[model samples]
Target chain A: MIDNLILGFQTALTPQNLLWCFVGVLAGTVIGLLPGLGSTTGVAVLLPLTLDFEPVTALIMLAGIYYGAQYGGTITSVLLSTPGEASSVVTTLDGYQMARRGRAGAALSIAAIGSFVAAIFSLILLMVLAPPFANFALKFGPVENLSIMILGLATIVSFSGESRIRGLAMASAGLLLATVGMDAATGTARFTFDNVNLLSGVPFVEVMIGLFAVGEVMYQIRVGAAAPIRTRFRELLITRSELRRSIGPIGRGSVLGFLLGCLPGSGSTLASFIAYGVEKRVSRNRSQLGQGAIEGVASPESANNAAANANFVPTLTLGIPGGGTTAVLLGAFTIYGLQPGPLLFQSQPKLVWGLLVSFFIGNVMLLVLNLPMAPIFAQMLRIPYAYLYPIILFTSFVGAYSIDNNMFSVWIVFVAGVAGYFMKLYDLPMAPLVLGLVIGPLFEKALTQTSALGDGDLLIVLSHPIALVVLALAVLLAAGPSLVRLLPRNTPDREREPAGV
Target chain B: MSTLIRIRGNGEATVYAMLALVGLAAAVSGAFYGVFVDGGRVGPGFLPLVAGGLTAVLCGWLALRGVHGRRSHPPGGPADGVEPHLAEDINPVDDATDDDVDISGRTRRERIHNLWKVFGLTLGAILLVQVVGFLAAFGALVFVISTWIERQPLLKSAVIAAAATGLIYGVFGLFLEIPLPGGLLGLGTEG
Candidate 1:
């Protein structure tokens, strides 16, 4: 291990390697900040540029882009309620709420801090436990995966604000919307209504841009922001109490993100969502979550960064892609004339360690770059609503068009924006709907796989300990709260206490 | 009949009813696809059957709750119960007309009018994309929005519109090379 660290340091600390790392992260931040682009697309587009470089150096740079985008994606989510990708969608729930209440700087700052802490924590785990985690990841089959998706469904209860029923209805609508495309198993189109674009289902990214950015901008215009949120420089900085409060969520988020992220196909997006749900279930400031708690900003942001790092574990150790970006990064590895797997680690220790080490260095650079800029980015809110919204509208439309170079996405944005406006008017939560849309496909695939493996019995999971344990967790998550409420209270005072609070 | 009338008139109840209708349609379609089309396998319709059925029942329940709550509470003021659809943060002390009005002194009607105007203009711009091209159409959107609705100076609005268009050009047109459409005017195409 000591020799490996020395070799890793030797490889990563070279002038060219460090320079490329910095360049990669800088490019990644820009790519991620744009509304339509994300880590997978960014790394794919830039892969050819690094083909001439050495394998270790090129992998280091590409890896930087992957993790750095996780940091950049949060910027827009906090400031604009425009998630650069699905992973940051949860951040919009509280981060934008914080910005509206004049704390964009604090929201962005804690995200950066939590992200920095999470990346370091996950990287150490990645370096030490890659082989073991990869083996464990293989144990998570269709049955276990189905249970996790069920667990995700149970977490929708967390996204419900004052009204649980309304949230569930929205989630149902979202799930129905998600089933619009072709059925992977049957090769049958369910709800496409004969439109070619609907065959791919409603694009999640465009829907996010519409429902959050365009919808939010239009709502602000109608309701009228009293003025731009103005704050002093001192107030723009995160308060000490805010950081202290974030400590628990950051720790919890890191663990949840790492565990989920280690599983191939779960990705940082699911990790972030599940992490936020866990925080809502356990945090002391749970009630403040939808209304802009600092823990809200910290938990999901930390989880995504941790998950982004953990994504590499399965990719490096098993030669299996962990998520979309890692899939592209794995492609880059093949392009660089390197084979990835258990044996490759022994053959290519320098490359693997160097890349892992570069994740650490690149994240440190992102923290340095993002921390002070958090307040600077918040200064954008000072631009008056009238002028700013037009610009945001322009971006929203053009960004939609750019996503697939299709006019259909633009229409989706407009309709979703209108829907979003109505939702705001009715005080309906959007988070649960987005979650339903995200996990809908995964849920269906898992169901099909489990049924196939079980020969339609669906009880094969009972025979597998891991699957059984996971399904039990799902059942507990879904039904435990209600059962606990049914428990008898021992004290007369407690029993007599108002159920209102 | 009275409950039906009340539900139609109540925004909260009406929204839930609409959602319930959608859910019902989805559930029926899902059942059709699963049993008739796919022969009852756990295929595409399985999730929709579950989710859509859940949505229909739950939304039906919520719609009833909305109507009962509104009926129990009169619509006049704070002396009455909470308004069914008003945002939680909103104070019901204001007059009914002002329920959705802005503190900026803009009437509800005026704001809704403005919202329609913007929506129409954007919708028009998107339709005009093949003819006038995305750049010109969006530029006009910015110009009209800033000047007509926001009441900015015409010259300033034009400049803002141009700058906004230019930024779009630089980002989508040049850097990303998105192949933005250039229609009759033949402008702003990276290709």
Candidate 2:
């Protein structure tokens, strides 16, 4: 581990890596702070721009964008009562209240501090746990891999919010879309309709750009932003008492977040929500929550940031994405000509370790950038949504066009954007759809291999102990919500929020 | 049935019904592709068949549940419908948002109109891309969206459009070496 850390620092501390990391985090912060854009859209829209760079450098920068958004989303939630991302949704409850009480600076500062602490804590956990997880995954066969894929799909059941069926529908839609290209098993075209572009299948990067960036812009256009609460620069500092109040929540949130984040599909948003809920139940100042308690901001913020890092655990170790953004990142690995999964750790140790180490540097940089400059960052809220929306649309189009240097990709963006708009309108879960798209090819390959191993019996997955256990777990995850719903309820339950990206 | 349809809400139910059709289409296509190919190997369409079939069933179930299903709001969640914060997620899509000005019906229509306008102009830009070229066409779309949809002043919108175009040309086209569609202008390295 020490040797790996040294190698990571050696690679990450390079002048080029550091420069891109700074750029990535800065871009990510601005992207997350914007009303219409979030980290997923941020990474998707900006990924094509990194095509000129080394794969490791591009990934480091993109990963920076991922974590940097965690801090950036807190700003809007605190000041404007607009959350830039789903994870920051919990923050706005008490964060905005803190601002209402003239403690905006304290809220923002504590959020940054909590997020920074959480990032370090989770990154350490990620670093320690991911290698061992990858080692275990290396032992997995095709049958086991197929079952794990089922488990991955089943995790989407947890993202079902109030409608398990809708989530399933979306996941199926994604899988259906993935089957458009030529069949690798038989070398026969399946759903291509003789179009060469379709033969390659729908590119996940372009789909991501469409769904997150273009789709989000359209959504934000209909729902305009509110005017932000003005905060003076002098009021941005955190006093000792506020930091003291934040300690417990921050610690609690970090642990809760990292654990939830490591689970495929749950990701950071759920982590933040559950962390906030736990703090509400357990904190000594619980009654003050949702009012102006610093605990609310600190806990969710820490959890979200920690969860963001923990998301890398499954992503790096299992090649199964922990959320929507990591799903896109996994797609990026394929685009970069690198196979994603356990082997990646052995084949690309420097790349993997360097990326992990850069998280530390990036969070430290975010803390330094966010703590003092938050008020200045808040000023960005003044930019009208009108200007931002057009910029996003235009970039999305251009980015799509650049993907294949053809018009078809742009058309895909348009179609996917419209689809994404309706999907959001209907409250459908987007993450499962994306994960399905990403994991589709892998799942199919595993199934094919497993079937061959079982002499044409696809049910051969049932015989392997690991595969059986994984399949059982998948069944449990999928059935858990519905079973709970069927059981008699003792108390009224608030409908759960979608485990959004 | 009329009462049930009304209670379930037309817009969302229609969306689910359409998805069911899409799933049916996929399943049909997968069946055509052959679920089991030669040598008894799982064919290319097997998973799609399974997934598509599942999608159809799930969506069909959803189309029924909408008559009066439980809401997704957390039990103790704030009633203001504050949408969850997400960087990768959009803002204030549902019941959330303190935007007081949009309460009027006219403004609501105008907002929906803006969304349509953006979508339409993008289609127009896509067609125009093969004519004037990608950058210019997209830039025009940006300009029209800002001036027309957003109602930004002409000069400001134009400058914004120009800057955006310049950024795209510089970063993606020039720097990344990812060829942009040259279209008629032939500015991009299409060959």
Candidate 3:
């Protein structure tokens, strides 16, 4: 293992691979700082170009974008009250409030520090636990995979903000969308409507870009752009007491974030949301939570960053995507003709270790780039949305059209943008819809594969101990909160919707 | 009918009716594709069939909820109860006010007018995309949307349009090397 790590470092230290990694991380930061654009889009847009590079270099670059974007989300959430990604939604609750209260500096400082700490902690944890985790994952079969997906689907309830019924409806809608395209088991088209693209199903990247970026831009235009409040560069740093208040939450969030991140299909966004919920519940200074609590900023900043890096475990070792961003990374791996999984570790030791080492370097590089540049990014807020929206719209078209050099993708983006805007206006959360779009096919495929393996008997899925345990854990993940709420003396309080929905 | 009152008592009751109408549209669209047969016994339409049925049920549920005045209830009490239209933040009376004021209900007409203008801008851009191509269409789009705000002068609008097109074309096309569509009068195909 030590030799492998040293070899990985030696390979990644090459000038070309290191340069590509830097470029990926830099682009990721810029893309992430912008509201609406996210890690998925960043990876998707670059995936085409990365195809021409060496496999290890491409993997290293993609990994940089994955973690770089996580760091970038803090910029927008803290300064603009708009989240760059779902994970940073928690950051907006207190970070924006702190900005409004003239303590933007403290919030920015704490967020940067928290992110750095959490990222380092999660990286170490990943290094320590990855081999064992990979070994355990090798035992998984189609039945266990199906059960795990079912558990994931069940957790969709936790995201039902303000209205349980609405959340359920959204989740159901997601499931229905997932069922689109061809049925992999029977080789039958499900909902193609005669379009060739539909045969493969709705492009997950296109759908996500439409829901998050294009849709968000259109919504912003409809609401009218607000004039930004100006601030000095010196005003973006934290003081002694602020730093002290942040430490405890950051520590707790790091632990929680790493655990949640290790779970396949769960990533930084869930980690941040759960972290914030737990912090609010436990904190004695609850009143300060929504009103600019530094702990709020620290908790999610730490958790999301921790989760972002920790997610690599599943992607690198288990060959499963730990989240949407990792899925894109996995897709990139496949595009380069390399499969990701425990088997890959043995087959492509240099590629695997090189990518892993690059992550540690990327984390340190991101901290250096982000912390000192907080004021610079915050200054970006002064540029009115009128000026910014056009760039966003133009990029939407360029990015969409670039997929296949086709106008059809661009048209799809526009329509999806309009649809997304309406969804926002109607107060529907877009994340669940996105989750359904990405995870839907995987879930259906697993179910079909498992059932087929059982020779038409569904009961065979329960026979495997590993599969049973995973499914049980997934069930616990889905129902644990509700069950805890139902416990004696623990009446669930009215669930408050997380900010930046 | 009496229970189904507006919460803020501002918008037409037809808002709920409109939601029902959209729901009906979804159901109708789903129904059309639900029976489009394919190879399998279940076929391609099975999922859409279930989806359409679910939509109808959920839409019906939402309509029923609206009719029961569930959404009509104000923050303090039931619907139809008399209360100040302005937010407590603006009133400076309630402790809940703090600093955040809800000004969304205000400037309604201006917002609506701007929306219509934006719709006009979008339509014009789509038309332009066909006539001139992507570059010129995008430039024209920036001008139209900016002009819709009514604050910027005509010359400023043109300048903004030029800048927008230049930045997009220059950065994404020239720098990032994305193969953006060059219109009828673009610099060159090499771009």
Candidate 4:
């Protein structure tokens, strides 16, 4: 393990890998700070640039974007009240409130520090735990693999958000969409209205960009833009009392985040929500919640960043992507003609270790890039709405076009954007739709493989221990959200100021 | 039913009904797929069938919930009608100003109109791609988005559009070598 760490450091420290990592982090920060452009879009847009580099360097760069964007996302959430990504939604509750209260500087700084600390801690955990987890992958057969995939699909249940029926519907739609391409098992066309492109299935990244980024941007545009509120750049440090308040939550979040990060289906997003939820649970001082609690910003921020790095554990060790972005990273592995499993450690030790080591370095780099720039991003709110919206639209188009170099993909962004806006207006959860889109194919393909093995007996899903345990987990995942809602409603009218612009 | 619907009240209830109807249609479509298709016990349509039925149930639930909300809080009180914060507000200030104005005039029609425009713009962009190609389609769409949706001044919008088109051409077409549709203006032709 020590040797692996040293080896990873050596590979990550090289000039080429470092350079790409820098580029990835830099681009990620800017894109993340921008509204309607999340880390996914940032990665998708820049994916073309990585094609020329070595697979390790490219992976490191993309990984940098993934983590850096998580850090950068808080900038908009803190300064302008606009959540740069879904994870930042909780951040805006306190972060933007902090800005309104003239503690924007402190909010921005703690967020950066919190992100850095969680990321570093999570990376260390990744180094220690990934090998064992990957080894555990050896235990998984076709039945277990299929069950794990089913468990991932079951996450749509968790995201149901006041409506299990809608959540199930969205997840099913995603599964149907997933079945579009030519059937790998029987060579039968499943649902591809025989359009050649449909024969290959819809690109997951394209669908994601459409659902989250484009749909979000259209919503923002229709709502019209806000002038970023300017605040006096006072002390940038957290107060002693504020620091004292944050320490417990941050500490709790670090531990909680690492655990959730270890899970296959739950990764950073769930970790953030759970961290925030737990902080609320543990708090004795109730008034601090809806009214600019520093812990509110720190807990989720740390968890999400940590979870972002932690998700690599499953991907690196077991060849399973616990989340959408990691799934794309997995695609990178296959693209390079290498599978990501225990064999990867034996055959491509440098790449595996280098990627892990680079994450630590990237987290540090992200803090340095973000802390001072937080206030500046807040000032992006100062930019007139006229200039900002055009730039937003322009970036969306550029990002879309860059994906496959085809205009059809770009058009999909607009169409999805429009569809998503309505979905949002109707109070549908976008994440389930996206999560479904992402995990659907994996579930379908795994189910097909299991059935092909003549494990069609529905009882097999219950009889196999791992499958049974996972099915139990699926039931729990389905129930967790309702339990959360039923939990004593903290505040009937929690004064939620919409994150600025 | 009409009396109940009327008691459910105006534009808001109508929107809910429309959404419920859409959900019902989707449910029917999904049920048809599930009932008809059978390759194995677990066919391809099973999931969709489940999703559609679930969606229909949820939509019905939502409509009922809306009705309940209306009943619980009758029209015209503080608890009734739309809350102040939730009210449709749209501020039509095109010029970006530092002075933050309360531009909160988002209307039901305006929201719907934007959706229609989005549908049109997307389909248009796809069609335009085949005719004039990526750059042209992109430029036109960006131009339309900037000038129309955003209501930017003509000159500013044009400059943004031109610069955006050029940047895309430079990065994607030249640097990345992704080969965006050249349309009538092939790569060799000088702009």
Which of the two candidates, 1 or 2, achieves a greater DockQ against the reference?
2
Model 3 lDDT tens row, A122-175: 988887788676677677777876776565545444534334344445545665
Which pairs of residues collide in model 1? Answer: none
Q: How well is each residue in B1-191 modelled by candidate 2, as lDDT tens digits?
A: 68356544656666677787788888888888888876688887797788888888887667655544643332112211123433223234455433324422225457777788889999998998777778888888889988887777999999999999898888776777666667788855455
Candidate 3 clashing pairs? Answer: A105-A236, A105-A237
Candidate with more favorable, higher lDDT: 2 or 3: 2
- Runs of candidate 2 with Cα error greater than 4 angstroms are A482-501, B1-9, B38-40, B67-106, B185-191
Error of 2 at A90 (Å): 2.0
Best-performing candidate as measured by TM-score:
2
lDDT of 4 by residue, A185-296 (tens): 5445545555766676777666666666666666665455444646444647778888888777777777777877666655466677667767766865546864788998
DockQ of each: 0.28, 0.41, 0.16, 0.20
Q: List the per-model TM-score of the A chain.
A: 0.62, 0.95, 0.90, 0.90
Task: Give the i-RMS of model 1 in Å.
Answer: 7.7
Worst 10 residues of 4 chain A by lDDT: A492-501
What DockQ does predicted model 3 obtain?
0.16
Worst 10 residues of 4 chain B by lDDT: B73-82
Docking class of 1: acceptable
lDDT of 1 by residue, B140-175 (tens): 899999899877789988998999999888867877
Shift in Å, residue A144, candidate 3: 1.6
**Models ranked on DockQ:** 2, 1, 4, 3
